[model samples]
Target: MTAAVDTRPDTAPRGIRRKARAYVALTKPRVMELLLVTTAPTMFLAQGGVPNLWLVAATLIGGALSAGSASAFNCYIDRDIDRIMKRTQGRPLVTGEVTDREALIFSYVVGVASIAWLALTVNLLSAALSLGAILFYVVVYTLWLKRRTPQNIVWGGIAGCMPVLIGWAAVTNDLSWAPVILFMVIFLWTPPHYWPLSMKYRDDYAAADVPMLSVVRGRSIVGLQVILYAWATVACSLLLVPVAGMGVVYTVVAAASGLWFIWEAHRLYSRAIQHVAEVRPMRVFHSSITYLTLLFVAVGIDPLLPF
Candidate 1:
């Protein structure tokens, strides 16, 4: 592992600013933003309004660190394959901005720091959840499942869903049906959110020898699965309306966004059936992000209203 280094010569970023960006790139900040999006809304719902500002700050920082640590470990672990996939070919590890030893050491230092920070600033439960999330992502998702099965993200995506539970636990230090249902909502949302992206990058995965669902399954099959998961994701989103006593605001937004999400999934399926030249799976992928943002935006907003 210590001998691992970026092999690409022409693509590596130069200068200090670019190098700094490379270090940050290891954390997969874009992915971290999406993960953190789900966290705050769950906290807002747990508190029935805005949670303590300090608690919110602490939770976000801790969550970010934990996510960054896990992502860095993934970058380190997948360094070899990252070089093969066109979409991943520009990663910091593949570009040689960061050494394998440096990435591994960074992963451990940040992982431990996040656990300690959350434990001191948030609560033991939140810290515990952070630790569990990091461990699960590295052990279950990256190492154990990612290369071995096309169903990898199906089970491994649970690590991404932990933010809901962590957010709720940070506020109340207890688990309930509400957070559990929210967790399930994300669990269901994962495939629809990811499969489309995988579909677009099927060739990349094929080159990497990583059997993502879109690589292993036919386009129509992937589309059908996306639709199924979209339906389930929508169903789970609505569960919060009754379980959490969510008001009309949340219920209406969730139902409408869910319908939109389902529509996109169906459109993707239709294109697959017709064998469209360019399926544009990214349309569905982009819509999934929009759907989650709108749904969680409602989660935060609904709690602020009296209803």
Candidate 2:
């Protein structure tokens, strides 16, 4: 499914200053901010507290560029449907802030630049992993999966999980069970984290004909799935305690915050079960972000503690 080339006049912004903001918006800054939150902490765990500042800086920049590259391509690819969805209606591409050609070119240029930067500044393996993530997001998830099935995000979420691996690999230049477990934690966490947002935006997806889980399934079914995945996410997070040799801080925070996340997930299900007029799934969505932040913060902090 090819997105039609945007022919709208480039009235995105007249000043160079204004145009930079439009390009940044193409990266979906909010999502990138969340993606970045996971990067350094994993590096911390890999290095056991502090890695070289230069290496850390390089990995974060590479990760950001890789992520931004993918998002730009996504903006280009989804330009047509983007206009139909209210949440995405004001996107630069939709508003003619950036032309399709510019978005497409920008995606490739920054994407290639990121790979080169990583390979030179970081390790080849980390760079390769970053490149793979870019390709998977553009080729597999965005192009093929997003519009095809209700299970789109379930598998497509693999791309989002790459930063953990990339961050770890950047430090160690190799793969191990620790990062893999953390990867699985994010993999499981994604569905529950995203489904609530999907639930809130179900109508928008429905109108756009995108088959996100909430659009295809009832709220009760989606809530049940959220609960199931929330449990799986918590289980996966605990594995880090042993696999990564994490200590008391991580163990306690993981266990406690996980229970709270599961409880919130249950609350969403309970509301759905009761056929409430409005099930506020955003509660779970926002909590999921906080849960992840706390879990990873502990991951970063545990290694620095004397205990």
Candidate 3:
């Protein structure tokens, strides 16, 4: 009877749990995971090897929470546009699972907490930078630039590039050429990384009245931009081997991955890129994920290699 009674108490809290889940969904967890991938490697490289476990944990939590805050706010602001896009139509706010007021409160609370956590455990520079990142993502990118121009992701790239710097600053508390290079890698990588996804959802952007490159520039023009950005990414990534003091292992890995990225970009370009097929653009999007993960991991593991 006691054992059975314990399980029955959940009926009262079930609604609360549902609401909690709805709020969590607003953070866009999958995107948070990718963002943290960059953060972890930047810290690892900054330390010239692995960092202290506690510090790494704190930085990751702060970065994730801050990113979540920015993302949640973006969701609320973009709720109208999201409702029109099938991919985001099922989101908590869009589906009425979560109220805008609740989401707004959650976003601000988390946003402030993230900054506080970083300031306490990491450094003021990191805290300031993290705050800047949130503002850039929420205000600069989402509110200001997204609907205004086709160069949305181009300048909006700054928000994503901030984590690498925050991670580096977490360990060293100072910015350096190494992290700057890493930042550039991601900054340049953003256009190609995101443009492919824009292609996948071009029609969605059009319907939602979002000025994504695929909508503004046409598939062929966007494809050309993708190729150009891929080339730029390759150039910047290759330069990191020497600048970051990466060993032969990292050099080989980055070179191979960079070449593959360029090849994919060319394939998209050479094909004329008119039709909205699922395979090609999705492939580019997935490949961009793989490319960044591999390059950052190579950097993280570089110091481990006997040189």
Candidate 4:
């Protein structure tokens, strides 16, 4: 649990800036960016138009806090493994930029603040969903599943899918099939989205003694699973057309981007089966992000279309 200490004076401007950056890194902002991307678009779809700007701002803030809390907790819990895995070696906890106690306290404070902020500004349902997401990511994924099961990310990804439901609940103050379908889309998308990264970092998980599919199963099997989940994600995205009466923009983008995503998955699988040394799994990893962003951008745009 120990990390190297900074001997420099704490009041120095450079030290202050470095400390701020470390705190920010503890939140895993890049991951939060992807979560927030799905959020506002879901709110737009829920409103069937642009939602109130103030409400959008409030929800995004609370969502960021919620995500930050979950990530901080994950950083704390996985600190031991973080020090071992090359991918996580530079995390604040691993680098000793933030202490274990500081991270624990920060996680609790932000989590509680997120619930309170959402409850006051958005609605109770949204706040509750945010709380549920934090708990699921921390308790279910980080503590119970991550080290124990290869299927951890599959079920754990439910937390990442929460923003769509929370955004809908914030706007409508209720649940419906439309958000559920979007939720399923993300749920299925998570495996394909994440497995590629795990494939790229198979040795990291192996070193950490974590049972990621890429660590536990052969590359070919993991590639096949990615293709399966990619197809399912695309199929789930299409459900929005009939369920929500989505228009031209969403339908075309969903179909085109889905085919692109599926193509990437198949390409990865091809490399895996051919026993190519590189396999270059990150290609599909980046492709998944582009696919989701484009699909959700269509989600936001479709509701405002003229015809």
Candidate 5:
């Protein structure tokens, strides 16, 4: 067989600050923060109280590191396509701020180190869950589905949905119904959140041949899907209060938030049907983020708030 070609390119002999920034860019901080937000509530909900201090800390740290590693590997894999997308053109890998060798080594080191910490300090179940998330993200989502199919995000959203499972397992060592419900909430939420961003960058995705919903289906169809997923997410979010044994405080907040989420989706559908710019879809996407964070935070604080 012929030797595999390394698609990785060279980087500059750079200053320390630039090098540091490249390493930081590999982690995709905003995405990691959002992932952690989901993790925190699962911990609290699992116990129906505040989570254990040490275990929560260990799991979050390990989860964040493993997430970063997988994200870095994604950058490595998508470097070429990223260069074609204006939105991702400045990414460290695309810009040659870091080499593929550097990224690969960094990803492997962080992934192994994070899993090792989880196995030793946290429970083995948590470690295995974290590793599974990484593998799903890197191997299934980034490497396989992304380039080949329009359904990539639909299937690959599983990796993003795993943090709640990890958090619950970290505490109870059991895969309870609560975390599974939480997974459903996030899984349904992913499409509406991402498709709008993809709509905003449809030309870039087309250039990269990435087969995003926005690139494959027309805007009308994708917008409808976003609305449908938005409705599903709201329905799933409402289930959290009863399923997780959250209080009336959580139920009230969820009902209110879910209403706003549905409103946003309706607005997006209206705009898309009219062939308006995707600004409304983008707004819905941002509001979806706020809705999830607020719903989960409400869940986390339910024990403190009187019903």
Candidate 6:
């Protein structure tokens, strides 16, 4: 007698993969990448050269988890507004790819795990800083500032600056002027880096009743503010050369890339002031990423160079 053969397709693996991707999307991986970019280089600078590979790896992992926790919490909190904004409508919570309850649980789990991971693998200071960052982003920025103030990103941006301090503390188990200056660099850079994206999405923000600077202010005023912040960012970046005793690589890269960033900001201002139909705010948005990447790359490289 021949045995009966069953031919049923396996759908479990596919369903699991889809759910995994939705959970990762709740973490905002792109934003996490930018935060990690600042972490390792700050570690390198803190070490005054290439740091211990294990320590660097541990710190980066902890930092990523912390950032992921903050972003997931933001997604859960902003789900209502996110649905109304075209730019955010595709987010996992907004798209129903992840439920509000699942996102909240994931955030708390990841947050507790990050603090524990840092405390065990890195140091208690790094863990505390990571916890502070999570609280600032979730409580201060998401709950208090985001809906009420156009200056939300300005103060909210403080959470983003914690990685530099955390990186330094991981290496030295303490803080100093070098990390503080780097902290300020990111603090000043956040406005110029974020405002342009807000400009492009001004209408979506307005519709959501989120008071981003670009939504409440005129384009020309926003453009001018961008230019001002861009200048300040570049200026603060220069302070690292003296504060950290950086060499030719960082000095040249910071100066040249900063000039390019300033030029992009000014071009946007010119367009905004002219009342041009298309102000192309994204140009500065992309330029800011390039500037920060180049500056941090130099940060990582300068310590290794024999100068």
Q: Which residue pairs come into collision in candidate 4?
A: none
Return the TM-score for candidate 1, rounded to 2 decimals.
0.94
Off by over 4 Å in 6: 1-8
Off by over 4 Å in 5: 1-14
lDDT measured at residue 119 in model 2 versus the true structure, 0 to 100: 98
Query: Per-residue lDDT for 49-127 in model 2, tens only?
Result: 8999899999999999999999999999999899999999999999998889989999999999999999999999999
**Candidate 4 Cα lDDT to native:** 0.96
- How well does candidate 4 match the true structure in TM-score terms? 0.96
TM-scores of the candidates are: 0.94, 0.95, 0.94, 0.96, 0.92, 0.98
Candidate 6 overall lDDT versus native: 0.95
Per-residue lDDT over 76-155 for candidate 4, one digit per residue giving the tens place of the 0 to 100 score: 99999999999988899888888899889988999999999999999999999999999999999999999999999999
Candidate 2 Cα errors over 4 Å, as ranges:
1-14
Candidate 5 collision pairs: none
Residues 127-239 of candidate 1: C-alpha lDDT, one tens digit per residue:
99999999999999999999999999999999999998999999999999999998999899999999999999999899899989999889999999999999999998998
lDDT of each: 0.94, 0.94, 0.90, 0.96, 0.87, 0.95
Task: Judge candidate 1 at residue 1 and give its lDDT.
Answer: 50
Candidate order by TM-score, decreasing, is 6, 4, 2, 1, 3, 5
lDDT of 6 at 88: 87
Question: Taking the candidates one at a time, how many backbone clashes does each contain?
Answer: 0, 1, 0, 0, 0, 0
Which tens-of-lDDT digit does each residue in 1-307 have in candidate 5?
A: 9999988654554577789889989999889999999898778878778878888899899989988998998999889898889999889998888999999999999999989998998789988999999999999999899989888898899999989998988888889777888899889988888888888888999998999988989878987898899888888877766776778888888889988987887887788889875455678779889988988888688866656
lDDT for 120 (candidate 2): 98
